[model samples]
Each structure stands twice: as C-alpha cells, then as structure tokens.
Target chain A: MARVVVDVMLKPEILDPQGQAVQRALPRLGFEGIADVRQGKRFELEVEGPVDDAALARIHEMAETFLANTVIEDFEVKVETSEGPK
Target chain B: MTARPSPTATLNGGPTGRWNVRIGVVTFPGTLDDRDTQRAVRIAGAEAVPLWHRDKDLKQVDAVVLPGGFSYGDYLRAGAISRFSPLMETIIDQAKAGMPVLGICNGFQVLTESHLLPGAMLRNNHLHFICRDQKLRVESTSTAWTADYTAGQEISIPLKNIDGRYVADERTLDLLEAEGRVAFRYLDGNPNGSLRDIAGITNEAGNVVGLMPHPEHAVEPLVGTGRTDGLGFFTSILKKLVNA
Candidate 1:
C-alpha cells in the first residue's frame, strides 16, 4: 500500500483570520520574528495499490474537485511514500 | 429564537391551493433554519415543500430555498462538502435552466462552491461569530427575489455567521456592478467585511440569489425583531412564478 497527501491552503490574496489569530498569540508564547502564518488543511489518503503517476493524477483531480475550493484556495498533492509499511 | 405561530395555516388562507405554486426548502443533515424558511414561503401564500439533501428529486416545486445552517458541520470548508450532495446536482442543473433558487447564509457558501455563483465566503475579518440585525439596501430589483422591493430601498434583516465575508476578483465585481447583478449592498457600516459592502448578489439571469443575511427570519412581523422587511423576497418570487 501507498500513502498520498493533499495540503490545502487559502490563496495568498485571501485573508486567513484564524491563522492571523494564531500569529498574534505567538509572541506571547515566546516565539519571535515569524514573518507570517497561514492555517491550512491536510488530507491523507491510503492507496490500495502501487502509487503510480495515474494514481497521482487521480488524486490531483480529487484535490481540485472536492478537497479544495479553487476560488479561494490552492492545493498540492504529494506521494508520501511509494512502498508499503513494514 | 422566539416562540412563533405554526406555519401549517397561512394568513393568506392558502393561496397555494388555488395557485398551485409550491416552493421547496432544502434541508441538509446539519441544517437549522429550514423550518423558518418553510414558514416564510407559506406566509408568502405558496406551498412549502421540504426537500432532503440526499434526495435527487425536487418534488416539482416552482422554486427552491437553501436556508441557513452549518451543513456537514462546515467541515473542510463552509459549503464544500454539501455542494456535492445529490440534491445540489439537480439544483445546479435546474438553476442553469432558469429555475429560481435562493441561498441564505451557509447556503450562499454552497452556491459558490457549486460554481452557481461567483466568489467564496471567508471568515469574518474580526475572527468572530456575529449575530445581529443588519441593514441592507436593495440594489437591484430585477431579480426574481427582489422585485417586490424597490431599488435603493433600505431594509433590515437578521444577519449571523462566522464565514460571512464575500470575496471575488476585481474583474468579476466590476462586471457584476456593470450588469446590475449586485442585488443587495450592506447599508449601515459593513457587517461582515464583505467586499465593497456587498450583502447579496444574483446570477446573470437573476434566478439565483445568495446572501449572508437571514431573510427567512425576518419574514413575519410578529417574530424575529418584529420586522416584515424580508417578506419582500418571498412575495417577489411568488409574483414572478405566478406571472411567468
């Protein structure tokens, strides 16, 4: 089995209020010099068979169609690993 | 929420019986305002039919209302998951074919997700859930849901939500303004930081309208802040369907 991952984030031009709130609290938590922060969602998928280019393409389509609202978000799909777990 | 009279009997003595005009109110799993929307429809002298999200049929209703609520628990995005529901497929097809559809609050988010309307809703700039009575100006009376309201008329309706800000590209905004597709604009100090104070908008054909405010809550004069300003939406569509 193989694992695929999709990371979704709001477009750079869109406002992310939740991320901003977290950023505002970082200083109080002793974090410093963080230029910016943006909150996003991550989806992990388990493939039943070998992770091939065709599977990647299908996952990309899923990201575009259901995982992300392209109007305000951008998503990237990556193959976490090509081999099954030990 | 207040204790309100049952909607089983309408004040108009059931004109729906004579006109045969039935309006559908769709309910998703997590929907909360479907009943109020049905009551609004009944008060407008039309039959209110309940439509389930999992069902593909629209029950032969002349028009449909997607009421406010956090469908699918607003997971992933406000309306992303619900837009893929079986009922939305039919809505999208019918809406494209010139059927009248109204989306309120979270319903507006679904319309955007379905691509039936442009732009997506974002979290309020202040990062807080706001609930209040909001004033909005009727900008375009040409839409099926706004014909009973004269242009430039300011009305107060209940607005509530966390994701209520509307955003779109500058070109699309300009095009909407140019074509008079901007159906409503926030009047008194933008409530949720919507772009250009846009409270509501209509599709190119004016059959689909989506807004952040809860017009269904303000339809009855005795309930919901005791204002009937929102009844114009239902009445407007009733006239349009009857006349058409």
Candidate 2:
C-alpha cells in the first residue's frame, strides 16, 4: 500500500485572516522572530496497489478538482510508502 | 425605453393580474433561509417552488434562488461541497442559458464556487462573524433581479456572515466596472472588507446575481429590520419574466 499526501494552501497574494490571527497570538505567547505564517490543509490518501504515474496523476487531478479551489489556492501532492514491521 | 412600474404597484395587483411566475428556492443541508426566500417570492406575486439539493430536476421553475446558510457545514470551504450537488449542476446550466439565478450570502459563496460568477469569498478582515443592517447602493438595473431598482438607489438590508469578503483578479474587477455589471455597492461602511466595496455583482448576461446581504429578510415590513428594500429583487425578476 502507498500513502499519498495533498497539501492545499491559499495563494501568496490572497489575505489569510485566520493565519494572521494565529500569528498575532503567537507574539503574545512570547514566540518571536517568526517572519510570517500561513495556514493550509493537508489530506492523506491510502492506495491499495503499487503507486505508478497514472495513480499519481489521478491524485493530482483529484487535488486540483476537489481538494483545492484553484482560484485562491494552490496544492502539492507527494507519495509516502508505508513501511510496516520494520 | 418605457418607464418601469414600481414593484409596490405590481405587488398591489397591477395591470398584469395573478401573474404565474414560479421561482424555485433551493435547500441544501444546513440551508436556513429557503423558507424566508420562498415567502419573499410569494409576497412578490410569484409561486415559490422548493428544490432539494440532491435532486437533478428543476421542476420547470422559471428561475432559481440559492438562499443563505452554512451548507454542508461549510466544510472544506464555504460552498465548495454544495457546488457539486445535483441541483447546482442544473442551476449552472440554466444560468448559462440565461435563466435568472439569485444567490444570497452563502448562496453567493456557492455561485462563486460553481464558477457561475467570478471571484472567491474570504474570511472577514477582522476574522469575526458580523450581523447588522447594512446599507447598499444599487449600481446596476440591467440584471434580471435588479430591474425594479433604479441605479444609485440606496437601501438597507440585513447582512450576517463570516466569509463575506469578495476577492477577484484586478482585470476582472476592471471589466465588471467597465461593463456596469456591479449590481450593488456597500454604502455607509464596508461590512466585510470586500474589494471595491462591492456588495453584489451580476453576470455578463445579467441573468445571474450573487450578493452577500440577505435581501429576503428585508422583504417584510414588520419583521427583520422593518424595511422592505429587499423586495425589489423578487419583484424585479417577476417583471423580467412576465415581460419576457
């Protein structure tokens, strides 16, 4: 089995008020020198068979069509193989 | 161009008596304003048809209204999940073919997600949910839902939402302004930090309009802010359908 991860984020130009609020709170908690902060979503998908180009491409399509709005967000997909009983 | 009759006059049994305009109101999971929207339609002298989100059929209604609420709990993103619902599939097609579609508040979010209108809504600049009586200026009367309102008319309606800030590419904003497609502009103060203070906008064909304010709530005189300024939306569409 293979694990696929998709991370979706707002475009750099768009304003992220939620992320900004978190960043502001961090300063009050004595966390300093953080240049910037942005919040995004991450999705993990488990596949049943060997991961191939076709499978990766389909996952990318899913991310583009459903996981991410594309208008205000960008996404990236990565593959992580499950290593069991190491 | 002939002078248009007042919506009040038409609602009071104008020349066209007992007009049979059927307007469909859609309800998705968590949709809260469908009943109020139906009432607004009936008050404007049109038949209100209830449409379910999972149903592909539109029931032969002349127009559709996507009312306000946190559909699908506004999961993933506001309106993202609901945009792919069966009802929206038909709504998108009909909207493209010039059938009137009015999206209010969360409905506006759905329209944007469906790509029937441009831009995406973001969280309010202050990161808080705001609810109040909002003043807006009617910027265009060419759309199917704004014909009853004169340009530059200022009216107050109730607005409540967290994701009400409207954002779009600069080029699209310029085009909307150039073509006079901006249907409503925020007045007195910008409620949610929307770009250009835009409260609502219509599509290029003037058949689709999406706004963040709740016009249905303002249609009754004794309830919800006690101003019927929002009744014009229903009356405007009825006038367009009857004349068409």
The alpha-carbon deviation from the true structure for residue B209 of candidate 2, after best TM-score superposition, in angstroms, is 0.4
Docking quality tier of model 1: high
TM-score, predicted candidate 2 vs. hidden true structure: 0.93
Model 1 alpha-carbon miss at residue B72, Å: 0.6
Give candidate 1 misplaced runs (Cα > 4 Å): A83-86, B1-17
Computed on alpha carbons, the lDDT of every model, listed in order, comes to 0.89, 0.90
Q: What are the per-model DockQ values?
A: 0.84, 0.76
Q: What digit string (tens of lDDT, one per residue) describes model 2 on residues A6-77?
A: 999999999988898888888799999886889999998998787899999889998988899999999999
Give each model's clash number. Answer: 0, 0
lDDT of 1 by residue, B48-158 (tens): 899999998887778889999999999988999999999999889888887889999999999999999999899999988999999999999999899998889999999
Q: Which stretches of candidate 2 lie over 4 Å from their true place?
A: A84-86, B1-17
Two-chain DockQ for model 2: 0.76
lDDT at position B163, candidate 1:
94
